[model samples]
Target: MSGFERSETDEFARGARALVIYPELPGRASVGPEARLAESEGLALAIGLNVIRKKHYRVRSPRAVTLLGGGQVEEIAEMGRDLEADLLIVDASLTAIQQRNLEERTGLKTIDRTGLILEIFGERAATAEGRLQVELAHLDYQAGRLVRSWTHLERQRGGFGFLGGPGETQIEADRRMIRDRMARLRRELEEVKRTRSLHRARRKRAPWPVIALVGYTNAGKSTLFNRLTRATVLAEDMLFATLDPTMRQITLPGVEKAILSDTVGFVSDLPMQLIAAFRATLEEVISADIIVHVRDISHPESDAQREDVLHILRDLGVLDDEQAGNQPRMVEIWNKLDLLDDDRRTELSGMAARDDNILMISAETGEGIDAFKAHLTALIAKGNDLRTVKLRTDNGAALAWLHGRGVVSRQYVDGDIVSVDVSLSRQLWGQFEKQFENQIERANA
Candidate 1:
């Protein structure tokens, strides 16, 4: 609250100012009450809003007009008036009437948790796919707030956006257009899903293994991935910084190649609608041979972020029963080690050394990065096909194809009997057989 310390008494400043309100469950303080509220406030701050103030009031009854006390509404209104704040940021969804009444009393714009999140998503979406998803979500969230818009629409009554028509109040028409666009976005996304599936099929037939980097937003997954693969991804200090999955083919130290996929970071309480909408884009993580759960070792909420990522993995059906049952190859990359003091960095280093599957590294400064890369190389070596196959000299075309398309182990030749041994996938072997049919038949003949 004290950072930068800007005053909001002026209208120009107040427009950017927000008042965050979180509901305190009655008589129960064991739910880490302060932490939850602080997390909510943190989300508001991350959404690029100026949180001028925040407060928590007890929720006494479901039908209560005021939050807690009889005159609590007016009290809050007076607070708003004093602060000159134009926006009330509620940490829970409000009924349309509730929102309108709150706005009427406070003389300020009122938005709830859903609306604030939707606004953030709307602003952060960059790609066509991302924009479509965000627009659909905004429409869905707006549909529930129709009552608040009805009066505004009656006065204006013009269909400015895609929601309503000329003759109808914008409220009714907005809902209709939302439904229509939601349907269209679904169709387009389905086409995208099919295309993604096709691309996945092609990758599956190839010999390279895939490694997907996933974690909470701003957990340094993209930064780490960029350093590892020498590919640039938009690394930012904001939520949902990278919404699209970016895959790059990278070669590790042992001459092993793998596709590195950097996916959108998972967040706590991510909307279900959004998960369903962008699940196709997350297929890279879902199907990876190995998942690297990157964590911000420097962050205070690192443990909580890890929990969120794990919960999302469970929800996405990525870490299924088999993964839970065994010590799967999923690794935890404890990133941002540079942010830690010497004592903390040493402690994390000790932990990482004790566990083969956990690595502590500073992805930004390349500290301990070589060791991390070596560990990845080891994982890929253990996970991939290291078996060597020797082809006969009679299969000359196949030999040429292997040299052209594969990582060869060794090659030897005698008259009419050259042989090449290489490490490749079973699928690649099938393709190799297909490529050498005539030579194989001739050798048999």
Candidate 2:
């Protein structure tokens, strides 16, 4: 079988039983152990794993060899044997030696949180650029763990390719080869980044504003994107359901056309390798005209999820203090109202009513979408400038440009000159001056 097809049958087979463990360290963790474990289980399920058992252990001090203490490791090994688990998934980062020791003790294939997430991204990334990024991340992650059998390298199919099947023969490769492959992937990704930058530049020259939807994984971003743009995108009740960013043209009140983008979801403790690999994709958010933060209001840890999303945004420089005044117009959306009880919903509604920046809606039921669109329209038109300009009657290009770039309120022809009144954003105004300023007779603002 081909590598990818083999991955489906071998790595993510229908009944591949897995043992999931989350180590809860003491101190102030924003998210509770229960919520964290639940999220981990959801991730395991997303990969087609039958999680036979899940547990959370409190660790006062972590061991260098194994993240868990000796007693805890022995208990896990015993549990694995009892449950007949084929895989042990640790909900934390693991060093190479730690992973090796765990596998030896438990006699089950082991992977850490980063490895699991990479596997999922590998399978879900549809675009060529996305695949390239995933591959690069996979290589970076596996480079350190090469001391273990490299059988996982054979598992590369649709994803970064490291989840080897049980009883598979282990293979070893020189680190030099891995280094060379990673270097090449970085060069190719850089090219992709440049091409993406050019596309963004062209869009900037265009008249349409860009709106990006960002939130925690499976937070209804794709659903809301579909609701607003009337475009069908993959919206499922699973973690990282949408990996590749999708963009579409949408019309808002008083705006002819606006670009809407649905981005990959953010999770707490997302691997740094992924952030670096997907920087090109995340740049879309940096260039957006408006940012809509979608939240799953029904989730018990909704507030903590919000903080995780914001932390990533800050890391992306979106929430930097220097860019505060210049940042994109921000809107917070509370989604999945249908999943909430009436009392809970009423409480949230009151909170949203008190905050102009927050809006409550159910994307599936089409509740409050009109108000959301109107709010976007107001934000886009907030600082627009109204101007009147005169151009030669024969200058049809300039007239068309004006009509396409902004909302034209009136147009009149007097002899060989055309007089028009229009509304233009500061950005569009600058572009007009650079492109057609000398050709115009005069402009009054």
Supply every candidate's count of residue pairs whose N, Cα or C atoms clash at under 3 angstroms: 3, 2
Q: State TM-scores per candidate.
A: 0.78, 0.86
| lDDT for residue 317 in candidate 1, whole number 0-100 | 85
Give candidate 1 regions above 4 Å deviation: 1-15, 24-42, 45-47, 56-75, 95-98, 150-172, 321-329, 383-385, 388-425, 429-445
Give the Å error, residue 166, model 1: 12
In order, candidate lDDTs are 0.69, 0.84
Q: Report the C-alpha lDDT of model 2 over 84-130, residue by residue, as the tens digit.
A: 89999999989989888888988888888898888788778888888
List model 1 lDDT by residue over 1-445, tens digit each: 0010111121233237788887664654333546557666766766566878888877777444434354667777899989987678777657777777777877887777666666566556667777766665655655566763434333333433445446876456756755665677678878888988898888876656788998988889889888988887888777667876788988666444678998888776676666766688887788887888899988777787777788788778887656642337688889988789989887878877887788888889998888877787666556335444445656656766665445555566666665555555556656866776555423210
lDDT of 1 at 1: 9
- The residue pairs in collision within model 2 are 122-159, 156-161
Off by over 4 Å in 2: 1-12, 153-173, 321-328, 387-403, 407-422, 430-444
